[model samples]
Target: MGESAKTEETAALSVRALDDETWPAFARLVEANNGVWGGCWCVGFHVKLGKGRTAAENRAEKEQRVHEGRTHAALVFSDDECLGWCQFGSPEELPEVKSRRLYEKGLVTLPDWRITCFFTGKGLRGRGVANAALGGALAKIARLGGGTVEGYPEETDDRKVSGSFLHTGPMVAFENHGFTRTRPISPHRWVVTRTVAPA
Candidate 1:
């Protein structure tokens, strides 16, 4: 590709806050990906899953949260196509996480923001979309009065992990954005933290 064309491709990817206005695109992306992680709708972090709730119910709840302004995410887009998203919100807004048992063992305090989930569209995984999404989430958090932000990401340096298992994102992604390793919550997962200044 020519220099300008390469630049254009890079410029084409944008990050937008997930809100009512962007819900349709998010929905489309999720639906296209089989509702994401077995029809999770990315709501697994916000509430306990598998309470006999169907995927349709989960979808409704997610849509309700979006409409009520109760959910937050950074949606990555290429043109009008929603490529993926990074889910972040306050602790109360997202109470559940992987390895909670171990995470609570060292919980001295709650963070202002928690990055709980991530999803990259099929065929778009290794293209820096998740990094963009993480950057976008931090920027949005800063604008909303930033504070200590935490993430639960898996360390992938030692072994190969499927993208399907990395809902909270990879550890290097958080480290790249300046998050420090706080503690190990699971075998290959950790609790990472970063403090962002208010914009």
Candidate 2:
């Protein structure tokens, strides 16, 4: 999406696309969190990590992808600081995913957009940053020619889950955004889908 496109905003925050202009803010938030999940830089779904691949390499590669416009996310900002982000892209752009074996076993067709991961600032947990980021992602997808969108979120009604393990977000969050539970991909995780009309 272009910079001129309309941004998704809330009373306390605004959402912007993760691009050249927003890269630094994104980096700052990630850096503050020790590169986010052991230096993942939120690039886990974009590329295969491990086997001596350093966090530094992931950071550099993520930056490179951002520069090349190969990455997509809805970055939430509270004033000038980035609070967090929700990563979204085509299946090809984000090939790696959670519960891959089960996910593929039930996969019928690829979605036009896939909502993979989310990250919120350390102190900003329990706030609506992730929800805002999700709204922002849907808005961005709408502007980018909307279609079928999918997300794998865990059900949290029956038990308590650590926030760190909720990178895909909660079932209530996606449901709040009008996504329907398409099918269960795991014991707790479900594949949710929604259709966003183009803006």
Candidate 3:
């Protein structure tokens, strides 16, 4: 955990878009944790669109969706090993966010992408994987044509919140990557956004 080791680890890490070819890596990271939040398969964000199914059903549907390239994510890797992941998509892909009233304020149609979820493996949790994944997701979104990207992140004070409740990440993570808070979604959560500069 020395500065130099941290630097080396950062250098060894890379981020890639989640697609059919990389689905296995993303799957492994989630599977290792028993599908994240007791077999969510990272599909809770879509429940507003009426995705009510058993964990087993959700897992199967998610896998089939990924096979069809229906998911968009940023997968962080250390050499060939997957360390973490961040999910992103057009606003249509990630809907029914928390604090709907606050989130809807000043809403517009231009922000085409939404950064919805993140997951870091057990040992990888505190090693800056989420930040890297955030950066990776933004970079990938910019590469596809920079647009307004939105996120919902918790703003924790001295009171500590468990990682289990941070799947959407924290305010600091988005801020570290240059995202600006758009509005307060809740006392602890805020809507944030960043305009990815064109590549």
The Cα local distance difference test for each model comes to: 0.91, 0.91, 0.81
TM-score against truth, every candidate:
0.95, 0.93, 0.91
Off by over 4 Å in 3: 49-52, 105-110
Highest TM-score model number: 1
Candidate 2 lDDT trough over 10 residues, lowest sum: 1-10
Going through the candidates in the order shown, the clash numbers are 0, 0, 0
Candidate 1 regions with alpha-carbon error over 4 angstroms: 1-8
In candidate 1 the C-alpha lDDT for residue 108 amounts to 100
**Residues 1-199, candidate 1, lDDT per residue (tens digit)?**
6778866776778999999899999999888899888888999988899768778988999999999999999999998989999999999999997888899999999999999989999887656788999999999999999999999998997787998878889998999999999999988899999999999
- Of 2 and 3, the candidate ranking higher by lDDT: 2
Please list the residue runs of candidate 2 whose C-alpha ends up more than 4 Å from where it truly belongs after superposition: 1-10
In candidate 1, position 4 carries an lDDT of 80
Worst 10 residues of 3 by lDDT: 46-55
lDDT of 3 by residue, 98-117 (tens): 77776777566547888888
